[model samples]
Target chain A: MEEKNGATSKAGDWRSYERVLLPPVRDLHRLEVYEQNGGYEALREVLTSDKWDPTSVTNEVRNSGLRGRGGAGFLTGLKWTFMPPVDPNIPRFLCGNGDESEPGTFKDRQLMEFNPHLIFEGMLIASYAMSITTSYLYVRGEFADWISLMEVELAKAYEKGYVGKNVLGTDFSTDLVIHKGAGAYICGEESSLMISLEGERPYPRAKPPFPAQRGLWNYPTTINNVETLACVPLIINRGGEWFADLGSHRHPGPVLYGISGHVNRPGVYEYPTGMLITDLIYDVAKGMRGSKKLKAVVPGGSSTPILRADQIDGVTMDAETLRDAGSMMGTAGMLIMDEDTDIVSWLRRVTRFYHHESCGQCTPCREGTGWIENIVTRIDEGAGNLRDLDLLIDLCFQMEGRTVCALADAAAWPVRFTIERFRDEFEARCRPSLVPSGGVLTPALGP
Target chain B: MTDFIKDPVILMPERHPEPVFSTEELVFTAEETRQIATWVSQYPTADGAIMKVLWMAQEKFGFLPPEVIRLSAGALGMPYARAFGVATFYTQYFKSKKGRYVLDVCTCFSCQICGGYDMLHYLEEKLGAHAGETTDDGLFTIQEVECLGACGSAPMLQITNGPYVMNLTEEKIDALIDALKRDQLPFFSSVTLPQDEDDLGGNRRTDVRDTLTYSAPPVAKTLG
Candidate 1:
């Protein structure tokens, strides 16, 4: 086992790696196992150790620079601070964004499934911080097994007085409920998730109410992603400074990045902030797989713009730096694309996804996404001219910043940039493969 | 009380027992009840948001029957169609009773390339039912869904309402189905956080890459 920066990295073999990093924690979904492992020590620590003050906890988190580990890297402490100060008369809400609907992202489900107790513990601490009594984890509808696992964990937490009335003999009582979202990607968005939790179409509500001031029944609500809540336990257990020490000043703490595509090792790698994209690819991922040449990467998820191969070396794995590189780390979903990949076809595939998944609530996104898909499909299948590319770019431009939600923008940006970065590649896909295209003299539009 | 077994179990007498909505069945925690009440207040009238409430009720109980839907409508002061429209409009909203486990596979383009159909076929053979059908054992429900957004890890399937299992081969699919059949929970994949592909097929967990290690800190560690 190799250790870097006080964190373990098992790289010699898969078995060794899983053993050291993924060590099983006695199946603590049961109360007995959890208590044995010092499960609620943090809760106990927070409660009795200096009489846990909600403001203190919130202040520590704010200082630690823990950002939401969901798609958008919103500052977790800032989000916590957004909650209206403790209100006893009004019902306070803590929503767990289990609607893991972003494409290429299922880390939250894994967190809930394997270490559900961890998330439950996080919820307890968060509920403690917010002075909230009622909380709901809005899990994706399809995650029935995970929901059950969470229920079991909740029962365990309850048995140990981690939840339910008079938690850990503290007057700060909070109850956690598992709510399911009916299959909508928008539900993963905080406002939409709140709406969905209230049992409406999983669509984003206009901001300003923002779930902090008015959410989940028009009261103050604090919604954190499952991973965000999961991180809460770590923050509480180990002091905030320990978490701050893991990553850089910009984006502190360990981020579980889901690496996939043409890479030799494609899985979730939790690295601290300020890690290089080169290290993530070369050291962590062990380079590209097979004879495939590296092409571009969707640094975040499909929504993020593609980064050229040359762009990999110094690209910081944090959100702000990646945004500076012309792509937001929308979600830490690094989708690798080999040289053999056709950008035209891939873009079309993503366009089709956006079109299909469009909630139809917004017309520009609903129509523009479908239009881009049709044009891109024609281009990919050898039925398009240069005009089609211009038209596609135009459609993307229109959908970029005009929609009520970012869904449209998410679909549009990748297509626009893919065309810009690899225009010739897309154009190459245009001429029928058999049609000789002057011996593949490709052009690269300036980035 | 109803038995755990899914049979024509009698909750009522032979002739006709007035099915009473138990406090446990209809009632929720004060917080949950308040949530339901708040959702009801969203519409122009109290009855308008009744279907939304029914879906919420279904979410709480897993499935909704005509009785529950009607009860919800009555509770929310909505008409039957409005409530039924809410229940029946969304694909996730269950109308007729379904099997215990619902297997939703991504049959979209990306998954198709990665052998989604083959896996679907395998599931059909394994479950002894075609898509949109349930098995005679009444334990599994299989349906093909649009993309669940893990295109990076294609050929994915969500098992019996669990995480999306991706990077799928026949063997992995078989292992997953077997696990579900035995009522054992399967492994969870944290491929990435689904961001853009929100609604259609996002949030499904996929295959665990053999070499991929979750939770490696940013800096490489040197062991003594």
Candidate 2:
């Protein structure tokens, strides 16, 4: 937590930190350029060499300690192991989740646009390890341009015998298809993504039947984030031990920290996990815009709890560190807010987003999101009493753990945590109670 | 208090409306039929290709009316109601007529904190139409949309759900509206990261034809 800005390099400069996911190579999106920079070599090595098998590859990823980059920080290799043993009679699928629709997250877009071949290579490697014949990359429809670009690149890969039947002349055969999702945030969820791929309304399924057990079309499937798959090739090439020693010991490997909102340099920076929050905002993002005092920071995407400026003194960008700091490392897309930002209006907007994207599947989520949005908007408009604050918190409790998916919890967390952390701000916007004493009416009122 | 406790209503789509296209026009062209067949082959079941085929239909036609949705469902050999449900679930699928250009302004959390509503209001005033309404001239429609995954370039808007015009300003909006008036679409501009400016000579992508550098976001005019 002592500002590990230059810890990775002897030069004591954060810029010296090497970018693994998005290397400093130009034209990496093209097949030839990516191959020149050691792109599909990992896939080629895995398919041809006797050193790696399905189990060994999974073990390497598990040993690397790489977690899911799409909000949930579950172990990628462990998730792969959950898949029932491969059967030739049944078809298994590997879904590369490119549905990067989270409000404050945009790093996956950069990866899909600029370094698409890395993702393809990673997917191919993962397919070989999982013994999956067909893989689907579900990209959000808003990324039509990127999707098209990736399609062209994928076709080239297929033509070169990297993805289609009999990959690299080995027995390993896999088909990688790019499935475009029409604008739904819920499809970003693993089960919902599978349902969307199967041409159904994308409502998230219950957790008893996880994706690995029964996924797309009721086949054993494993879903990995686009950025998470992009790391597979790196782990294969450089060894899992090297990846394990790259960043935070608990959550190792390079992560794409997408810094946005009130920052001078608001863009995706590839640094190892566990980068200091202060260094990210101050040093990496070139300090706050116009030198404004930092008021709060949403440590991850909008669903992650917002941290007061004082509370993030020694916070780092890792799952455990952020969890210990009373937030989740949900995508690591930090939305920084300056002192001038109105907390009430900001929370209102955040609540409105959840309300707008509730998907209407569960009663708690559909109704709870609407109720939360109405209450927060009233508080924002200075038309609420002090009791409304308590009411809002109570509403969150009703919705938090009583839903089909995390969307309800996502809707509830911002309202609950924002009021808990910034009660003074919400109280200032609300009208004072008419009855002064708690549970006691004034004598004048009785008269 | 009345606003907070409003009753919920399920507004139904038109059950029987005048058809926009005739029976002859509803049929897909031979080339389009071949394309749909190719999409169907990629999925495990024919239904999996419903979204791609529907997207193609929306592209060929201006929007998806009930008949058009039925046409797409028939092309995929699926039920019409299933396709309709899919279309309604996604906001990108145009269920009705829209302007030549649909400007999706991102006013989500990141953009909101960085003057997203300011740009949205500017467009509303310039076009004489509020969000979700097409302009009177039928040239544009301004929609205040959720995040399009480009939060780094806050205050951005997507033109016709296509190219993103990022890091928006008043002057940029004026120029964009004028160009769009003349039926000239803006070029795709790649946003270069700040680290690329120092390490890789201002732009990291050599394949990109145009690039926009990231700068400090402008302050919001009104938080509300």
Candidate 3:
């Protein structure tokens, strides 16, 4: 058995890296098994021990080089530091985002549904570090099963004195509430999550008054991903130095990659932060479905730009490498597509999701997504002319970086990247079949 | 760059369930009010409990009506208009009365490739109702929505807004409809929540663990 060091990958074989969060054990969901496997031991140690203070916890996290496992890989400890000093009258909170709605992203759902106590334990330690008493775990509305599973686990935690006031007979206390989102993808965003939590529409709020400053009823709040918080207890149990040396120096720790789409075996896998794309796709996920030639991979979630197979041949699946390769490690979704996929039809299907999910708050996203959807649909159905292709490119540029939220940019990337990488396919599919005169299929200019 | 697509891109304009209106005021029973009171205690403010109040109102009333929204507002000590805003905004809350079972089939990118459309088409043929229409028998209403994050088990459906039976099949749908008609389905509430026992899915007990919970160790922990 490994010593379970957090720093420096003793992982001679990356496949067997430290299984801090997603340990491969059945019945680990049981409280007895979880406690036996060193679960909640960190939280108990932090609250009961004299050596580790709240500030020390924060500093350790900073040193660990942990980044947010949500779309944006922001430093986890740095995000905690953003919280304003505790105001006597004002309150602070830690929001655990369980609303995993990204199309190809199902990693959060795994943690929330299976080993839910990890999330609860992580939230308790996080709340303790920030000196906040209350934390809310927001699961997606459609994830009713997850909601139920969490409810059962939380009841166990409270009954055993892991959560609720005076956890484990310590001066520190914590309150964790489970919130079910009401079927909105935008609500996954931190501000939009706050809006939904407030019993309102889940529209992303503008920045400057970020959640760290004035969040959730105008108080300082830190919103962390389900995967991000799930890593906290593991980082706490082993020292920060141990965690920092676990993976890549820049973005350290284990990463949960959700592989779906055209994979022979589609499921979530956790690996050291800087594993190669080929290993994840071929070795870990068992290669493409039907053993077909790999065409493209959405290195991150569908939001990040797509990476053509050629570009990702030797690339590592980390934030920096994917970014350098014209993609991102957005949630590490890693959707696989085979050579037989119709790029045009795929783009049409992909673009329509953005259009349908647009919050209708920002002009560019509200209007631009619809435009892209219309044009792509026409092209896919052979109703578009050559003008539609250039028009699609123009629309992509206009919508990117032009919305109130990053969703517009996320909405724009796939459209631009799909066409950018597969222009020939889109062109080949362009033929006059059922060209609607004035609707989505309408040619922008004379054909 | 393209003025062509400037036209409105409304999605599933047909998905809007017609409002179920009644001149009579909507009210909750004593038990319903009592159960919701427990949730309200957990929230810092009454406003925060609106989702629970609305969910309970829907669970009890079958669908959220204008009167029920107003009634929920009163229960939560929130303005009726605010409750209306929330009920209207979310896709989960149905405005009109649906058939006894509302079939929400997911047609997102993940589900689409895995014969999700075939399931929708099959349901239309089986139930004699289109995607957004209720059957004349008042047994089922059908509609399509985006991803529910259950991609691993694609071609899934949330049976009448309860348990999500994934990796869907025609045979399963037939059995589900039969059980639903007979009010004999068990997994939606019993196993899914261990609370309601409303016949959606079975409860997950260590003594009776679901087949999905595997004995095989996860790949990451092996091969070290």
Each predicted model: what fraction of the native A–B Cα contacts (within 8 Å) does it retain? 0.18, 0.84, 0.40
Best by lDDT: 2
Regions of candidate 2 where Cα sits further than 4 Å from its true position = A1-15, A435-447, B1-15
Model 2: per-residue lDDT, tens digit, A276-374?
889899998999999999999998899999999988877778887788878999999999999999999999999889989989989989998898899
> By lDDT, highest first, what's the ranking?
2, 3, 1
Using DockQ, give the best candidate's number: 2
Question: Evaluated with TM-score, which candidate comes out highest?
Answer: 2
For every model shown, what is its TM-score relative to the native structure?
A: 0.75, 0.95, 0.88
Q: Clashes in each model (backbone N, CA, C under 3 Å)?
A: 30, 0, 17
Per-residue lDDT of candidate 3, residues B162-217 (tens digit): 77766667897888888888976436321222111222242334443343311111
Better of 2 and 3 by TM-score: 2
**lDDT digits (tens) for residues A1-447 of candidate 1:** 122222222221212222111124534455566668767787788877885588888887887888887778899989988887666688888988877766656456556655677677788889889888878877776776567667776876777788988988877788877765556666677777666555444557677767889988688989888788877767777778977766556677766677766666666555566666767676677776664677887777678888998776566767766777777776677777677666676677678778877778788998998889888888877777665666677788788778767899988988899899888887776543333334342342312
Per-residue alpha-carbon lDDT of model 3 for A105-203, expressed as tens digits? 877876675578898898998998898888999988888876887788789889999998789988788899998877888988889999888887667
DockQ of each: 0.12, 0.72, 0.25
TM-score of chain A of each: 0.88, 0.95, 0.93
